[model samples]
Target: MKLSLNSFVVVALFAQFASARDTQIPLEWDKKVTWTEKYGPQSDQPFSGLLSFSHLPYTRCLENEATKFDIAVLGMPFDTGVSYRPGARFGPFAIRSGSRRQRATNGYTMSWGNSPFNQGVKILDCGDVPISPFDNALAVDQIEVAYSTLLDRPSAEGMGERDITRLISKDGIEHPRIVTLGGDHTIVWPILRSLHKVYGPISVIHFDAHLDTWEPKTRYPGQTTDQSRVTHGTFFYLAKEEGLISNQSIHAGIRCKLEGLADIENDESVGFQLVTADDIDDLGIPEIVRRIRQRVGDTPVYLSLDIDVIDPGLAPATGTPEPGGWTTRELKRILRGLVGLNFVGADIVEVAPAYDSADITGIAAADFVHDFLSLFLAEKPPSVGPPAYREEL
Candidate 1:
């Protein structure tokens, strides 16, 4: 049979395939495999002991007597402080659920060159603060008490004074730093009070569309001088009045309509410098980072991120949606630039999942929390001079 080149090639390929198929691995080898023992249960099974933030072990504040943790993930589920929307109470749950996506990756950040989880720090989710839905004031008090309890050591014989500035490890137990999953912006006020007790007046790195430094107003439409007047819009005012924050504090990404000239004046009165969303255009992100580092130099800092700080197009699940704002990438860059700052506590707030589609806002909030953890766990830079306060004119 005179074979063309194509016919010869086809015959050769078939012969090779038949020969290869005849030498397949023995069936006994396949039967000897312990598939269930090697892989354990199904890969898709829901993770146990998972709380929001990583798949860190779950522990309650009251029950952590034996296990000492360096960082505690807490959820504040109260949202009575919001003026525009009511669903921020679900912020913590949504943020946690979104964080499950982060579990597969080995907590390595290229910028840090180390896994934050691999740091000497031990992290635990302390679960959510039990807050009252009906009483805002009571809920705030509950949050404050819960936070204080987590950060403070109980008075006991031979247990010396608690140091708020640094985590203390005594008698085989360690004090914890807190990362709050927020109910709303107002939750910061109570968390600040808790932090002030430990770190004294800390500087705040506030990312929000509104200043959140407005004077207190009625809680609702009909009420006057209500006890719950200190709302999400006005908690920073309360924080400043209570001496919880330092004058070096700064606000970024503010683009909401303010109450005429007085609003700016009022915010200045609270001692925060403004880095409006427009400023990102005028001054590049590096300059913005430089300004923030300059403002918060060497001070114990608390970061409060309102989800609305990002543009509504990217993060539409927040209570207040502002048109002109930051992109998630820009925000991430700014946050990464803030590594080595003295971050004692932080929160990602105003995430109302009801307003969200496809969990975009929730994922952003969770990732922000992750970035914060990385920065907090990273080594501190050498101390600069005492952070200077910017006074209102």
Candidate 2:
């Protein structure tokens, strides 16, 4: 067989394009911080930990513990509350596997500030909470229990009967920062319950395709189906009713549902703000960030990210795919804009791998999760100025 000159040139051009595509834009933060490879499980070093969830560490929130790490990565691995899909229960495992293949460090990369590792930030994958299939209530209960242990209250405050003084004297400390991986959006209820119990009056920044304010039961007429009758749509309402959250502080993204528009208009107590799909173009990214900041303020923010907030074409693996959702760049910009605020905790929910062929959704979900942590962790600790020097001279 003879190859023509045109064919040779076409192949050469293809090689050049592939080479360019393979290259990544070098990160700017790499110059400021010292980078090191991790040695064991969850560490950036070569190890078998990231590949399998079973080997991931589940450390106790004691003063000194075996698996003590600063930023604990927990897997909620349950989706029973979902009224639309059953596979999100497998989300945590899929995300973990994806992280291993992606080969990115689970720690903060120094883009805007110092590396989290150098700043005493630790990251540990605390494995998944045990889950029961198709049982929303049980799943929520288990998640609460798992997080309660992680929160680490003293025995006097109804924690496990461990010797407090003895534990505190050691290196490990309880009440460490927590980063959660979710099975579905309903998982937010339990996490909020736990965090609110510890950090009261916490504000929430919700990224989703709906306001998620629908009452589980409403009197609206011609209601063929009560959209909020199940766990999928009633998380916020439940949180509000239980007094676990301040309704005024909630911010939602790209909401498109008209099911509860009248309810929002008539309600006084629940002053939830919606950044509807129509507003995305008119308001723009900076304005959206301003609105979120205005609504949330300096209150300790809890970020709840539902993958469905992205357009279905970009994220088809979610249980409820809504059109006209935020683009990836927009989401990245929004998250980056949230830096320096008091972010107490966060969760990335609703990633179902069973629906996608290329694992693109999971990859996007992982990177989004990574970027959220990076931005939050890289934030500079508020400066405490030195004592007044007027007397010096």
Candidate 3:
């Protein structure tokens, strides 16, 4: 039986519409988000009840309670530590606001091979840590104090018999990863300090343009001691000297030393396996992952991503924008490469939301955060409960 061309055309149109609806539909996996109306009274508003930011209740851990999050996403808005760019303190909120709008999509392309789907990853935005408006010195102190509470050891201060039992039983068990949004690149120092206190000797995957190894104690003249104390430009030197991280496991991305390669090679205390922008072009991203994995293996890795690692053409909202940086596609590929690694903590830093047009930098930064979380979640057990972000549903 020959079907008419008009009948065939009608059938094709129906199928196309159905496919579009399916693609646009939000995934129903996030079962914890409870959305509500804000501002107006319950009667006057379109919806009742105030919106709760937390997706999960406080059933375990003291650190979780103080931040009002099972997994807190705090922002460190400190850029006074930077030598080049000054207005990165506003990075955290912009990144969060931009990421809050993206739904699940197959962001992976065929060039990266068959990348697996992200499983149940529970991430929450815990908001930004307070900073001093007038004083740069006070801002660093404030961030340290705020982060210290989150990194505090478990306590017997307010625990019942049941709570004590749970604590003892779950001792040595790592829970609720912290995804910190940054004000400046230096904000990662306190976070790494916290993570090192709990999960010691973490391997750092430093993605940036500069080596950031300048210290007051170094031979470089005119570098002051006060400047080396807790600034954004010199965290690597501090981390090495203070023994927060091992130099052997540090991998730097998109580097260019104007003074020559002597600085990086001479520093025995900070041995960076360099992945220059040209290295990405010559060897490709798969090789980039292979090298990163070789050095850091399956250890508890901390990913410190600077948005300035992207070209100014792509990401203009950073303090110091490099000329040849990773493309969005390449950056995503690198992230997908680290999916199975044991990542305890991570941060997406140096996104100055105020500098971009239509918040494009914020959008890119947020998307990177989303991709990182996706990779992190891909490692979780398959049978666990759904993700904790269901407000979109």
Candidate 4:
């Protein structure tokens, strides 16, 4: 048989491939392992004695000998109080996972000029409350009790005594500031009730799409069950009724749908002035920051930031997402603007990782927590801000 030039080239290429295949290393079939990690898990993880945030593991507040610390990062793994979705019970895990890379040592970022890690404070990762997923009422009580126990604890003996926020406790003692990783927005009501015991009526800086102050009975008209009354949507109303929060609170990024215009009036009756998401365009970011500062000036304030406050397009892991919200950049800039406020404690909630993609929502939530720690320090940001960075460290 006569062969064409193309056939000759094909045979040559086939023979060359067979020769290359013969020289290649054979694939491993056995399952025996030889590779080993160079360092222990604690070297990179933030927590000690567990699989959680990169800090000291703690949840012994109920015990008589819980480790004492200045500031603690607590997790609320209860989402049963949510009105729209489930799975936020896993929010603490996701947020903590997002925060794994954070180390207090060399924790400086040029964006803020300082890092929460280097602030001369012992901020431990107090692990999540063992909230009962079966009962919302029990879960709510558990969170309140857990938070109060930690909130009332004494600050680290010598550290954070230099804090100048003028925030005083009922006992005239220095109390620890807790940055909470929340399961849902309903967690705030219990937190406020807890802080009320320590700081009396504290102010609020609520960042969310909805006016969570809705009077459930009035707004829903017929779903008047006791459980329905105190959901994520109506916890603020419950707080106002219980006098856990002050009228001095303000709500930024308000743009959620309401039952009617009466919802605005109800929110006002609950003592919140609205700063809609669109207000950033007309009022400007600095002005919005000014209003928040002016309203809560030196008062013991609690900041509750919902992950849904950022546009769903940017952070979609939230249970109740409303479009046309602030970008993560604008949100961070506003948070930085709030550097000097006398906030006692704060939470970033409604992070349902089941709906999230690319871990954007979790990263945003974790970074918010980082900012929360810095805000407690109350160090004035530089006039021009921290120097820009070349790349990630």
Candidate 5:
């Protein structure tokens, strides 16, 4: 490889971080978020309820969930696929709880200079996929079918719909964009398979400390069954077999240990370019962004972020906690750089909050979700591109 990856850290550097502000709901929020007594209370206030992510609740049948919304956040609670720690099934819940403090009134972010909430994009927290705990095969089917159903739905408004590569649907209206909360990394296989039916093969921006493209035949040699071959460690291998990947897929913050150099060769064979975690320190955010943006070109992109991509020291609730990883801020800044990519779907996985200290890991994941919303709603900055965004649904 031209770029030397030092000891090849996937360390995106998510070590111990600033503890959250006093988590108690502030009384002053009532005045800012709630309606005065003369008028009724603001029914949309987010801090005090079991509603949804960021108090943005829109619970309905899956059909209704996608029809009116431009973007929806769905959760897949399956973690039976993990090779190690197994509490990521609770990731969606923890991320939502972490976002309790984010209300529309205070949703403005300094980076993008706008509030993602109430930005004319209908966003909903579409709850979790009721995956079967006992049956891994059945759970896989459930995730694929569930994601496909929503992707087929048309929204009331179109944000960036492009039919040049793949048709959004019949009549060519925009299909809603989905921001998923994941069960584990294995869930990405079915998502890519499902997306393949709509967008054809997709380029992926994978953020992880490990290169998860292990060949199951070698990694799990004793297991020969169809389902046995696809653990979180080997699902990308499965995706590769299914012809679901584009050559442009790239992995950032990849610092996981491997058996030998052949693993990197194998990873490249699976259609991924690597930018090790230490590369962030050497090249900085802008160059990393430029590399990713140039690599994917105009392909429909799917972003899959493994929470372990950040230094496990900071965000330790993931299945495989590698020591060095990206810091929460650096990762978010890099994500912001992806403002104009043709993003079709995205997910944050392996955030097992049960192991968290002060909920920092979950809070960081929720903040990434917030960044995603702004990315979906906001237009690309003029300085960034000539190949613009397509509002499909």
Candidate 6:
């Protein structure tokens, strides 16, 4: 208490040292520290391992001992069928790159109350189909063959099985579902062919700005049939001719101007009811869901989402973007409402990233795929073990 100035200085120095020694430092001072190798290997780098969809493991469907997966994502990089834009050939890459955003979390959706990646489903990116760039006919045939090859792969045993009451197919075989990242809407034709071979003519829930059911028209006036004219606009027409779709199919978010009134008649003739973009305000999301469920009740459905179905302000990097369409929020809500529908396959197409602004369209496309996967996983039976997120995280 009666210390001198020099004594006070010495006491303060000793107190400071004591405090510093008492504090527990985070680093191990006795251990050898190497600055260059402090973090070990960088496994999460973009260039490492397989660049498959959403950075998932890459597996081949045609391999000798292929890993059985519940869902397979195959990229169809063929875009010759586009009538307006050509760069949708790069859509699958853009979508996969943008999907890195979802990897930070557990890939969970609050809207669905579950993570698609955590529901005992084994998913793999099976890579892109080998497509012909020069010959459209040959390209179509190649896509059909590639899709069929993947569809024929056996599903993972006892993984992500649906409820017994929901298994309506008489064959007792639970085929693996596909989530195709698109080249264009034309890819749906070959997909329809493949799905038909497995589960006969399916009901479709088509979302687009255009009807995409146009008759094949010739460039010249004197032609009887345009054998070389299988554009994206005419795929559903061809599907109708081949009896690949049921009358219960429906089209939503359609707002494009048509060549004539016959286009609606033609689309209706091909077994599709129309719900234009303008109808969203009048009917609301719940009514729209009711309409869709009532139209394709208890049938196997193939969901096709064209990016142009979203407003160009939100998703401008599509092949044929129209002015009037749904916002991203509206689209997500509508997709979430389609929970119990028997969705066998789905695709999000027409994303041309060259025209995208700051990857807004790519991110939107990735979100759609995520939402589709959530819907698919949510429809499965209860998991036999703890959820993957609970155990892995």
Write model 3 residue lDDT over 102-140, tens digit each, in one string: 433443424323222223233345556777756666776
Q: What is the alpha-carbon lDDT for the whole of candidate 2?
A: 0.64
Q: What is the lDDT of every predicted structure here?
A: 0.77, 0.64, 0.62, 0.80, 0.81, 0.80
Compared with the true structure, what per-residue lDDT tens digits does model 6 show for residues 1-393? 688999999999999887787684435567887755666755666544556777787776655346677788888887888878888889998888778766524676666677778777688788888788888889889989888777777787445455321264446567778899988899999899988887788899999999888777622233335444577888998898999888899999999987678778888998999899999999887778778878999888999999999999999998888997999999887776677788889999999998999899988998899888887877632233223222221
Q: Candidate 5: where is the Cα deviation over 4 Å?
A: 1-39, 42-47, 63-67, 160-171, 382-393
Off by over 4 Å in 2: 1-66, 101-118, 153-174, 219-230, 266-268, 380-393
Each prediction's RMSD to truth: 7.0, 11.1, 11.5, 6.3, 14.1, 7.7
Tell me how candidate 5 scores on lDDT.
Answer: 0.81
Model 3: C-alpha RMSD to truth? 11.5
Per-residue accuracy of model 5 over 89-200 as CA lDDT, tens digit each: 9998888888888877789887767788766667778888898989999999999999988877767455544222235322344677789897888899999988888788
Model 6 pairs whose backbones collide: none
- The runs of at least 3 residues in candidate 6 whose Cα sits more than 4 Å from the true structure, single-residue gaps closed, are 1-41, 45-50, 63-65, 157-170, 218-227, 380-393
lDDT of 4: 0.80
| Lowest lDDT 10-residue stretch of candidate 1 | 384-393
Give the Å error, residue 352, model 1. Answer: 0.4
Against the true structure, candidate 2 reaches a TM-score of 0.72
Give residue 245's lDDT in candidate 1 (0 to 100).
Answer: 87
Clashing pairs in 2: 38-45, 63-172, 71-122
